[model samples]
Target chain A: MKCRGLVSLLLLCAALGWVLVYSLWSIAFNPVGGSLPEQVSKAMADSGVDHPITAVLLNFRSYDTLLEIGVLVIAAIAGISMARLPSLEDPAFRTHDALLDALQRWFVPLMWLVAGYLVWAGAHQPGGAFQAGAVLAATGVLMRLGGMPMGFLQPGYLLRAGLILGFAVFLLVALVTAVVGDAFLAYPAGTAKYLILLIELFLTLSIAMVLLSLFVAAPVNDAPESQEGHQ
Target chain B: MTPDLFYAFTGLVLFITGLFGIIALQHLLRKLLAFNLMGSGTFLMLVGLAQHRNGTDPVVQALVLTGIVVAIAATALALVLIRRYYHLAGRVSLERDATDEGRP
Candidate 1:
């Protein structure tokens, strides 16, 4: 036992040492940096694209954002389908715990209020659709844990609408822009910020609903062992 | 040290810690948490790299933002799979017998 413990200690020390060395090397030799070529910077300056990060995400790499949204949509749909609780099974799953029941009485409304604030805050700050959605999902999880009836949640229609809302709104805005003679997804300079904010708001609501549905759909074997034995 | 350097170092530490946690933890949920930690570390690194005198790189921020969404989607799927497995098997850990395909 002593020898084994000593060996494990030595291995841990070695691993820690290696990690330290790697961290130092990575920090010192970051490959992302290079002096911007004068022509490139000049062109960017001429085009008035001041923020390189914005230019890359919004212009040079917008396709990645589009794909990411698509993935989110797919995941939400899959989660909802998997977690669909039939009306018959819903009543059987309701919780009888008094303590949980009491706590949820106060917590549910509070969570919704907070989630709304988080969604609104996303427009001008670090809070956005993702954060707000996660918060709302947590509330849903809380409700489920409290033994609230699944039928009250309106799981199907709410989820379907949410899954489509963000992408649809974003596409609609882009289409409008295109119709007005701008390139696809390119908003007029003054309106771009507002447009992005609008898209983000929808995105957050959709994301929250999707996440909540995913969490709630975590499978539980409601079937009794007697039924399984007979089968 | 510069703020950029500070953020970079913090991110590096977070990444390493998350790597260690991913390797050491037995629970799938813990592994997911570690993965998220690693992602946050990467985000920090990206943001740190973008911090410049003129301004930060919008492209990297946007890319990272997009990556965050994708990660969550993948995570949601994995969680669903985990939940399903747990429900069916009554255990989360993979057993040696299962690992050995048809040995039994």
Candidate 2:
């Protein structure tokens, strides 16, 4: 039986290799390589940002980011609905691992600092709200694994605010810009930088919260038994 | 092969591997991970194509970044749906009941 499985896997790999070769040949025949157009580059510059990606994410296509934030919120809400799920007799994580606790005492704060730095550096370099939010969520997950499942399930007000603040702020700003006679999300000429940062700050907070909630709400607590639950 | 071709082919291989895993795996967690693998494969292709030249295209990079964020959201919602299914049905595999094969 083991040999049979290996044979099938080898067969699958061989078939997939042919597919890869076909794909590579096609790309070699028709290459799709080009730099950004001059208009886009000039537009990115005019957006009052040093980083092109930050400019695209926060200025050029801000609406998409807003909807992306909405998607995250909806996902978090769905995940949180399963928070009342039935876990195993033993808790999901070790209630107290001294080593984990000792490390978290210092590491978590440092992690937050790095996350903040990522958000700040986004103004010019590769780091940004999403990177910072992901790092922040990593700390949240670490804290939970360190016996504090409540790290993400903090007070009701904080939870609601963290989840809604980003979406609400983005919407409000879009509306304000439209009312001011600019397009939706078109920052008043000179104020694009501050507005983008403001939007990113809220987005980072909400994204961190959403990811943390998603991790806490996953139903893999009874994972070991589930592995053998089938015939 | 040049680096661009190499990386693009690697991405395609990753996508195919994830597709195989999604089709063959019975475990829901494994399936979820395979989906993530597929997402990453797509991202690798985008970035690799953009890297065809010396400097990467900011527009493509931005789009890929957006894709990553949306992918996470989709995965989270998919997880919730899977968890709920398990809660109600008491199993993780998407297979039909043994007796229900060939039903309309």
Candidate 1 regions exceeding 4 Å error are A1-66, A84-89, A96-110, A149-155, A222-231, B2-7, B13-34, B49-66, B89-104
lDDT of 2 by residue, A1-231 (tens): 746886787688769778777865776567455547444677876787889888888888888888989988888887777655443112555468898899999999999999999999999999999999999999988977887656326536767788888899999999999998568888998898898889889889999988887877776555543554553
- Model 1's CAPRI class is acceptable
Clashes of each: 9, 0
Candidate 1 C-alpha lDDT tens digits along A160-213 = 777788778877877887899468876676665566667767776777666666
Model 2 interface DockQ: 0.37
Give the Cα error of residue A77 in candidate 2, in Å.
0.6
Error of 1 at B22 (Å): 4.7
Q: Which candidate ranks first by lDDT, i.e. highest?
A: 2
Task: Identify the leading candidate in terms of TM-score.
Answer: 2
DockQ of each: 0.36, 0.37
Model 1 clash tally, residue pairs: 9
- iRMS, model 1 (angstroms): 4.8
- Residue A125 of model 1 has an lDDT of 44
